[model samples]
Target: MSRITALTPDQVPAESKSTLDAFTKNIGFTPNMMTAFAKSPIAFNAWATLLGSMSKALDVKTRDSIGLAVSEVNGCNYCLTVHSFTAEHMAKLPADEIILARKGHATEPKRDAAVQFAKKVIETRGNVGDADLKAVRDAGYTDANIMEIVALVAMYSLTNFFNNVFDHEKDFPAVTPAGAI
Candidate 1:
């Protein structure tokens, strides 16, 4: 592994410090991923706000399911662990369902659709066809929800690529380590 930088709030630029400060107060600490994001506060804030808004606007389980599917497909352990925590603790998705999604299984109709759609979107890389969207719609998502699904995929993709490139070791539970992907 490349010698990893210990990113901290104090080490961040002032504008990033303020944004990360809000995260620290709300979550007790800023995620290591966010500190990595401190490299460009303008981009970080935009991503953070979009991610936050998506979380708030959707059913938490749906959001987490899509996120998990994307991360798992992308092999992003950092994104996986963070969203897995959210899925289990905040979203309250069943553990079995989370496991199912992780392995590309559809545990139920609704979850299956979300995970399947996310997988297709990620695998196809924006080349998803109308049938994919139709399946997502048939699964009870609206056009707006479909957009959020895309957003989740995009968000996970961005973070995963960044983390993998920098070897952004996971902090929570520290399940992920310095070994390169």
Candidate 2:
């Protein structure tokens, strides 16, 4: 159960009610995290806006893949579960690919580099060595792509830490991590 109570649309402030409604209309339910964010509409709007902007930085598949990989590393069951569903359904990743992604790998070399880099950022706390930088670049990721990955890492980390800390209730089909990498 969520340590933080999830607010229904009727319960949140007016500014956040529409966003909660749209979430329900689009996804069929309000994610518990959003319900937590409903406590502060400013936080909700900031997260929503950042999510929109960060989403454009990478393809859906790559973004979802990174989410899975990072959640695995962080041991965030909520993220693992939600991201598994999103990766499979919205991103249209195959089951095998989803499993591979959680291990920081991909069928495509460029995407593999990206996931691996994301993993390194989390594992090393963003203190990657020069060789780490060279590997991603060698795979054709430009400086901009690298920065985007870092931004995505930060974004995913925020949600992962939030869910983990709050013990947020899982609203989607549950998906457990295979084990730590």
Candidate 3:
């Protein structure tokens, strides 16, 4: 059960009706987080726009990796489950790689750097050291890429915090974080 009740399908605001319906058509349901966002059209649109813009940034695999790392760091089961499903189905990442990503690692060097940087950003609260930036740059990421990395962290962190605070019921296949028993 959620701490704050999410509006039912029929109660979704007009501004997000079509989009939520599209999500329902594509995935068989509107995600709980989105239903909660529907309570605030501005919040819903901001998240949707940020998500849309990210489609042009890093590859899905990299974004999924960062999302997994942020979810783990924040201990958000909702995000952990959602990102796990997206990582495997949408990103087509290998099982082993998804496990690695939850631990803030990647088999690929460049992605590893980005994932590690994302973890650092969360651990340090955006106070990453000089060597942190240099390490990612040495891995062939430009300043623009770093900016996207930060954005991905911010984006995932936003959802992680929201879902954890709201206690949104899991709508996807549940994935326990690595250390959970």
Candidate lDDT scores, in order, read 0.74, 0.87, 0.87
TM-score of 2: 0.94
Comparing candidate 1 with candidate 3, which one achieves the higher lDDT? 3
Displacement of residue 57 (Cα, Å) in model 1 is 3.5
lDDT, residue 14, model 2: 88
Q: Give each model a TM-score.
A: 0.84, 0.94, 0.94
- TM-score rank order: 3, 2, 1
Summarize candidate 3's per-residue lDDT along 1-181 as a digit string, tens digits. Answer: 8998879778889998776776677667678988887788878778878887987888999999999998998989888888998898889999889889989999999999999999999878899999998999999999999999998899898888988899888889977764562
Q: What shift in Å separates residue 63 of candidate 3 from its native position after superposition?
A: 0.5
Name the lDDT value of residue 163 in candidate 1. Answer: 70
Off by more than 4 A, model 2:
178-181
Cα lDDT tens digits for candidate 2, 1-181:
7788776657889888777677677777778877887778887777777888998997999999999989888888888888899898899999889989999999989999999999999989999999999999999999999999999998988888988888886789966554843
- What would the per-residue lDDT of candidate 1 be over residues 61-135, giving only the tens digit for each residue? 766777777777787777777777777777787777776666655666876887788889898997988998888
